[model samples]
Target: MKLKLIAPYLTLIFAFLIISCSSDSSNETPVDPKAANNKSLGTAARDFLSAEAFTGLHVEIAYVNGFKPSATTINNLRNFFSARLNKPDGITITETVVPATTVGSLSREEYVKIEKDNRTVFNAGDELAVWIFFADQNSESDEGNSRILGTAYLNTSCIIFEKTLKDFSNRIGGANLTLLESITTQHEFGHLFGLVNLGTAMVTPHEDEQPDDAGVDKLNKHCNQEDCLMYFQTVGNAVGGVMNSLPTFDEFCLADLQANGGK
Candidate 1:
């Protein structure tokens, strides 16, 4: 199947900046009521993606023309997350059309500048910005690999391929594009919101010559285990290439939010 050919999702890379010297209380300002609530971890053993009231997370999706993503793509992604998350305030998804833009050979500086310049459509911590670059998602030789289908370190946002949003028959279709896009956003945003891995070092699969241990299988979710967004093969759990069909929340993610006072 075409879905199987799509490489499984990879963990996001986060380079945290430590502000060594600062007595600024505002910098450590308490999280907003909504964020505080999202950080709350309930004891219910129900799905991590429990239905709840809308928290009003506004998502702004921007596309660099030549990549050609559809208008309905963003909507599909929003609906998927909405069904799983209880954010009653209502989440808003908006599409920003940037004409005369080419996705070819887009650089980090170009992307970072575009994001900073479009502050009217985006807010640093509150908004989820989706940028679709004109690149091949399946290309392993991409020098700027981080520019597509992954999280950006400059501002902590999501970027994907325009090909991912196509309706090609006999190929990956439906919500698969949106699902992959959202997966990148969800995982990266999890880190920005204070979710840390249980271990200090980022987990890698079988770096040594030892046999692969079933216990170290980070792709599969198991009972009495921590299913974090940083899982090595998080995308493998989903059906087809559609990430919405997979489980969105787990104890580890919930607990991380709670520890950071997101609930």
Candidate 2:
């Protein structure tokens, strides 16, 4: 089915600036928390790609009661990670079922707190933990026809607007629901890997120029290739002119990952 969208559930990357933590006792900041999993997006690209720092990758899937993703969606994500990451130890994932939420929209700070309260993984020892929250609510940042489907907000954190994506995909008889979920999830992870100059530097300058929005994030973040997985548009993940399955990252995005130590 062709997905007709009024406002496409677009992927958002906040190139969030690394927040400076407060001083400790002797005017020295603590090293652990500063470089912890809560840092800005894409800052830990090498840690995720190469096994130099973190040999094992653990993914924490936390979702609201009614919004847990299907097994197919999770498996697609695993396959996507296996193709790029050099985690010989392996990439593991687990699901956490949280209570259903009532909020109509989620805020950035609210998302951070959700992870902080329930996240059990972190950048510790030899494993780097990633937390993906499947939120039942849309983002408070959504304006009119511009809704955010998934976001790469922090280095190790991502939020998927399950409600928005579900509606966008098949609410009015659109594309396959599973494909949309897989694509949105993988796209968010792309930002975590620093695609398009977010954290992973480009081997060639292929950043897509967006003139529609004036925000800092609307510039220098997405791929110039419209059909690439990291493309700024929602149709980037569609196949054969439809949203049928997840699309692999374009060559340039793949090159960026390799240069940054990915497989």
Candidate 3:
């Protein structure tokens, strides 16, 4: 009878060990496929930007009529990007400028139509294309004053805008046109990089709390830090200051880029 009792206890102990092992195996953490893919893509993008010597990325610029940016302005823009993007090794920037033509004043709808047409020629690939229109852009609702400076289509890797830099130069006396142009370009590109609360994940809370007229609940798609290039307040206004001093990507902005596969 004692032996029989001991045998049943041993069987129970063996069954308990088997169940424990099964539970442990089932609880092992599973790998996330989406996260793995995103990480891989981010790594690849960084590698492409950091290459020692290669074709690198291409930026095609098209200007309309008398709004062509000067050589000095172009060089300044290139230098700015080279320092931030290439770092030590330095990457190549291939710029192709299209000559001016007669593109008169355009409304918001007309501008979008033109942009859509340009997309066919520019072809959304690895290259970045920018179209600079000479005419002013007026809001669809308010057609009195020129509002928008620059706009970037993240999906197409394209930027479209008018000569708002010149407008700012006129409004804000003693402002450098070239520098303003450079800042405008930088700000638009910042949007493409997913600054503030855009596609790129923010390392810190730099998003502005101010609500735009559109009645959007969340923060504006700009940095809260007034000095950041991504700040919306700096775009068209000359009250605080002018774009003679080009804006830069602040620490918080840089941190977001670093996290999102940028140099």
| Whole-model lDDT per candidate | 0.36, 0.71, 0.46
Better of 1 and 2 by TM-score: 2
In order of listing, the candidates' clash counts read 17, 0, 0
lDDT of 1: 0.36
In the range 38-127, model 1's lDDT, one tens digit per residue, is 122111112122223223455566665545344454555566556544445556766665544345444444544454444234323533
Better of 2 and 3 by lDDT: 2
Candidate 2 residue pairs that clash: none
Evaluated at residue 99, the lDDT of candidate 1 is 49
Q: What TM-score, over all chains together, does every model reach?
A: 0.49, 0.83, 0.63
Candidate 3, residues 1-263: lDDT per residue as tens digits?
00000001223232110000000011112112212211211123333333333224445555555666767767876776575554343333434344432355444445445444442233123433233333333223222332345554322233334454565466524356666567666666566556555567788888766543477655656777777777665543332243346678888888877776566
Q: In candidate 3, which residue ranges exceed 4 Å CA deviation?
A: 1-55, 86-104, 107-109, 112-142, 156-160, 171-174, 214-217, 236-243
Model 3, global lDDT? 0.46
Residue runs of model 2 more than 4 Å from their true location after superposition = 1-35, 213-218, 235-241
